[model samples]
Target: IEHSIYQIMKEDSLLYCLPKEPLQQAFRTNKLSVQGTVYGYVGWIFCQHFLERLGKEYLFLIHILDRRNPVGEEVLEKLKKRLHQDTFTREYILDIRKQYPSLLKVLYAHFLTGHYVNQAEASNQPTISYKRLTAMERLPGEDLAKRIKEVTTNYHERLVFEGFLCFNKHVLKTNLYQTTKVALSIRMDPSFLDEIEYPRDPYGLFLVYGSEFRRFHIRFSDVCRGGIRWIRSREREGQSINVR
Candidate 1:
């Protein structure tokens, strides 16, 4: 599992997406925080390779989104064994309901108020709204909230990790934005790309990687005063002619 994931990272240009100067500054200041969601082996593998490349004593925090499931438990055991005696790491394997009550409340209020969504849309960048949150369910806000509440109470639904991550993106940008240098997610929904608006001043980087048929492709975008500018590799078709 580890080897396969490492190969994917290598082939997919994971390191290329990161800006070198900001990364080095992060390491020097010792304020680097790498946060991501882990469902199974692949997520953990990405974390391992990421830390190895960072090449220093850094902190890693991962949320084990599937702690209750059998597969989740299996991976947890393997991860514990692999990361044994690692000092600069912390793992959270709690139920989502108990883990983030305050955050949930804030999200609930956002849904009802739609203040953030309006703000984002007026700025031409939409915040994560009820439409984005229930994109999978295709349900109304009231219904979706009820379903999420059920999951919170019973903890039977399989969307535990997905729900938490979707909701947490808002907090990452607002509450935790200053401290968070880099945030990554694996196999995220394509719609999420539009929702993320990385701050230009503080230099926060968000990377999302997705794989199809064992091959990985990445898209890089940054915000400019005009709009979002896409940075593509020169290897892309019809671009080499202009490389000189």
Candidate 2:
């Protein structure tokens, strides 16, 4: 089956709420790593029935925050507080974070972290991951070690890489899950590698859906590459950024 990234996204319309400038600014600046993450944020904002809609406002704050580029400690704190209070309702953001950790990380970290405040405080904990060789190699613009670091550092690592996870509706006699690794190609540019890198960013989207069969988690990152049309392309053989 074939799916259009633009068409599928428009279904709920994550961008529908935000004014055009901030939406484009987000893509340019690489805010909220995954499209689905943005989608979830938007959905939570709409919070239908009992929910309050604040996604648009959250996006607006991000844009204004970028534009104002506040300097003073007091001013920054006040703006931050205003943003926290007006845009992201604490309960909703926390709930969404549990559901979409990576997206939230991208969004929060973008606004909060600026150069090293204290070098000694940086994380030193070891990462648990291993690399796998693939028949498919890196695309023209990507580096191998860089690619590994990108996938390993992301939210999916612990969930799928540590243990294969898939949401199956039926209970299995045993918790059976099939696993495989594909060095899937990823975007390095907005035009796309070979073509245009659709929505180019260091982190790509990886979506998991209910399925009878298990799939590599990295494959779900985006429809353009992960989607069926990508699999059908003959040129698609040598461009995965994954080790599995």
Candidate 3:
């Protein structure tokens, strides 16, 4: 009976997408909205989700403190606080080393872009496609220890580690909004948002959950960019239409 009970619990543990955070932010912003399957809503998951987790990850903590690496001021102040603790034990080090590859696989899955090509007649909520490659396809289990070392030295690389890094011609013209509330909605670099040549609409993202995972999550999900879903719905350029 004890073995039977253990088997049932182990089955339940295999279920991913167990929710820890709200999957979408209920915000009234024009620039963009963002979401993730696990943590819910975000603009820049890199900072809110990735960096926040990196700070707490034991493997990362151990790597950042190694004397052989160079860390930035942003991370150095964090190191000062971590200095006083008895952070790593022999067992903890060994376990983190073992867990490192699986962790990297999960992290790398979020780096590539998600694009869905379906239409929902309801215009306010056009469903985005988020097909995830089986964990093994996206994550190379090779030299994971060495790859993790890169993140410790430069925290910004965590964003790169998440997906295939590419910017679409659809720049999500964030600056067109008159208020700072709009520009600041996207928490990452706002370099291209300027006073001239507004060419694109602000495209937002929502988390994949429930049926979205089954219906979407294709392994070759990155082949088509998802911008057309937003672009087609808008009034033509040079026309007086502001889509929120």
Candidate 4:
């Protein structure tokens, strides 16, 4: 009886939420007003029904986290060091090590060494070029490591790392609204945003829950690239329009 019960529980655990057909259709057509199989409302309704079948205990499966915080430089350094020393399976390690090539011998060595020398020349640094074939000439893995060490030791690189860290954290959160909000916040970067142009519209809504039955107005600009006025109606002809 115990073994049979365990099998039943395991089978139940295998059940997964079905793909929201309406949401998939919206992405396919890039339109919001489609009904019947295309209406996301039906998918949402089905989700509510599924949740009821699972009972209130199913709420424990939800994950909660704030994802905007950036990881420190110390954290990145530690992770990099750990990754460099990683030794799990021999096959995986060999696959990665094969990606790095040491400076070759003979004429090939001189040719490959010039690639690095040319970079120094472009940067106005003292340059070395070899025209002769020699077996001794080789750039060690340490040379590549040194170059990366110098490249990443900068304020701009640190800023970019911070942005990447925040993005990674946001992806782990796995909530649609939180992911969108974090991405919108990061787009405020001036370096790239200034050269690009985009439209704006005022889109707003509120998600209400809990005992107080309170209201929280949400501004689309706060959670998206800009305000986009979605012209939604029961009529088929209505198309979404927006202001810039």
lDDT: which candidate is best?
A: 1
The sequence of per-residue lDDT tens digits that candidate 3 reaches over residues 1-244 is 5433433342233222232323222212311122222211222222222122223454455555664555554465575334312233223233332233334334334332222222223444322222233322343334443455554334334333332122111223221111112111221222322222123422232222221121111122335454212223345632222211
Candidate 3 stretches with Cα past 4 Å from truth are 1-29, 33-113, 119-244
What global local distance difference test value does model 4 have? 0.27
lDDT of each: 0.33, 0.29, 0.29, 0.27
lDDT of 4 by residue, 1-244 (tens): 5434433332222211223332444334533211111212222221221111221222222112122324444454454334323422223322222222121122123223432222222344332222222323544444533433454545433222222222222221111112112111111112211111113432443322212121223354546543333333555433211100
- What's the candidate order when arranged by decreasing TM-score? 1, 3, 2, 4
lDDT (Cα, tens digit) per residue for candidate 1, span 1-244: 5434433343234333332221233334432211111122222222222222111121222243455777866865656444432422223223332354343333434333422223222344433333333332233455555656655544322234334334333323221112222322433333333211222323233334232111223343444333223455557643432221
Prediction 4 TM-score vs. true: 0.15
Please identify model 4 stretches exceeding 4 Å from their true place: 1-151, 172-244
lDDT of 3 at 9: 41
- Enumerate residue pairs that collide in model 4: 201-227
Task: List the lowest-lDDT window of 10 residues for candidate 4.
Answer: 179-188
TM-score of each: 0.20, 0.18, 0.18, 0.15
The residue-by-residue lDDT of candidate 2 on 1-244, one tens digit each, is: 1223322343223333332322243445554323324323332322211122223544455455554554544554565445435544435343433543443333223222221121112444321100101111222212322333455545323222111111111111110111121211112111111111123432332222222211222332344453432232245432221101
Stretch of 10 with least lDDT, candidate 2? 127-136
TM-score of 1: 0.20
Residue 184, candidate 2: how far off, in angstroms? 31
